[model samples]
Target: MRALDLTLVLTNMPTTTTLRLSFSPSPPRPLSNRACPHGPVISQLDFFAFLNRHGSFLTPLSCCSLEVDRRRRSPITMLSYDSTSNVLANQFQVRELNDETDFETILSADGRFSVCGFGSLLSERSARSTFPDLVNFRFARLNGFRRVFAHVTPVFLERGIARPETKEISGLSVEPCEGESLTVTVFEIEKSEIPAYFEREIEYRFLAVLPQTLDGKPFDNPAVLCACYSDEEFLRVRCKGSKEMFFQLYGQYNIDKIWQDDILPCRAYLRHCVLAAKKLGDEVYDNFLDHTFLGDRKTTIRQHLATKGSGIMEEEPPESLKIRYGG
Candidate 1:
């Protein structure tokens, strides 16, 4: 039998306990331990909550094997055990953490932080490049938002894909809409790996959202977060249109001074996002087409797909782009 060692600290109290469990492929036996007289009851109660959530492997034990470490401590960092992976297979439930959730608590809780992707990140390859250690790369739906290719960004220009002449200089962003939901990919990454992530997702402000699983279940954690929408200030400036908003949001990036309505999506980037969705399966592809829209928010991707414009999203990147940008 292999022993699983778990050390926990209860934020609601001031105590620490180290627990050890011996595991096998059989039913669990009733195990018991006495809480140290000095330890608070919270130290014992939260222990049960943790175990209860880890599959149906353990019953509501009245007591737990606890070794008191009386010295004050920070939240214990999570240690992964092989036996726990199976329990994590379906972690779509409500999170106990809040918006101002403690970093140490979040980082140590199995290192499970979610990132929502409704655009190019629908591609596993694209997402993995940013979050190499990501796990549970799965699909979910974000309610109360809709996708639109209206965020004017410098990334397209940096990659040499912008068409300022045709106003195809926009990336993707989401806007709040009552009773609307967008299909998106949700994946887990360690909190420690996100410094570079902020750089890649510089245009949008990341916020915590509870995306619904395919089966309509809530995720166990709400820290599944990423930048998908503009902040209030950006929205206020965006009223002047995509071009004006871009200038206000990023001053130095506008070296070319070529700003426009951003009525169309960046050709190369849009095509990449569309093809990535297609590869996820029919549902995702259909969702991308039916739910996505241009800056006007009136023309759907599907409607555009029915026109000659479809060729832009289906054909290869331009010859000039090939020298600068790969698929």
Candidate 2:
């Protein structure tokens, strides 16, 4: 294991002063008895450059240190490491460091961290369209949550809704089930990408969730259930129409209106989602249907297609809008 140590000291003086940095190999002895191979002192610019070059060797929380003097409002920095000579040979084991508990603990401490994706994000084309920075994704399941079609978008009549609700309301929101889990494609993203990720889910709220991998182990990252509906909305929709009536109304809406305005209808968008799930194999497709709401009811993909008819499939999306499902 390669390690880095840096120390920054600031003075209490009000006027500007030079910041001092000390870098040394780990002790058998302290810096007083040793000579820094890089040199005794380095400029702030050089220090940043060195960090850029060797940052991967440092642990997640060990790369930098900042201390502020409340009295003077001054800052202090620190860095320390043994030697860079054997760094490559003793390179850090990233995977080992990413153990489930530790990874979850680190992210949970930040409070504002989460990784969650369903609906169009489950499809490669839609995901890529929305999150260009997303690179790796895994099939995971969120327990105690379900999918619904409650979010009303201008283009698509409805969007997937995930929230805690009772079975008596709309069947779209995930009800409090004892053992059921909602299937989702969880993306592994850098901490910096979080803001942009939530940007696409503006209507949703992040509910902390710990998703499990297909093999049943906890995924080694933070996740959230992105809920697009609330308790009030669920009850309101329930009073408005039955599931069959909702679909009937949806079917009568002009699909071309969406296409002419360069948008996708709810059913057409759903076709892409179904195709993506089918590509993931039977288990995923079935889980998707069992969890998601079609109008006011929960129906299988076949039933949805048969009832909605080919009109929902009328608008063939351009290749760019189509998703190539699976890895």
Candidate with best TM-score:
1
Which pairs clash (backbone N, Cα, C closer than 3 Å) in model 1? 93-218, 93-219, 93-220, 114-224, 114-225
- Candidates in order have lDDT scores of 0.57, 0.44
After best superposition, candidate 2 residue 310: deviation in angstroms? 4.9
lDDT of 1 by residue, 41-159 (tens): 34433544443543222321223333433322111222222242322233222222212243234442676567788887888888886677889888997765667776567867766
Highest lDDT: give the candidate number. 1
In candidate 2, stretches whose alpha carbon ends up further than 4 angstroms from where it belongs are 1-114, 155-179, 231-265, 295-301, 309-315, 318-327
Cα-based RMSD of the predictions, in order? 15.8, 19.9
For candidate 2, write residues 45-84 as lDDT tens digits. 3433443443222432432333322222111122223343
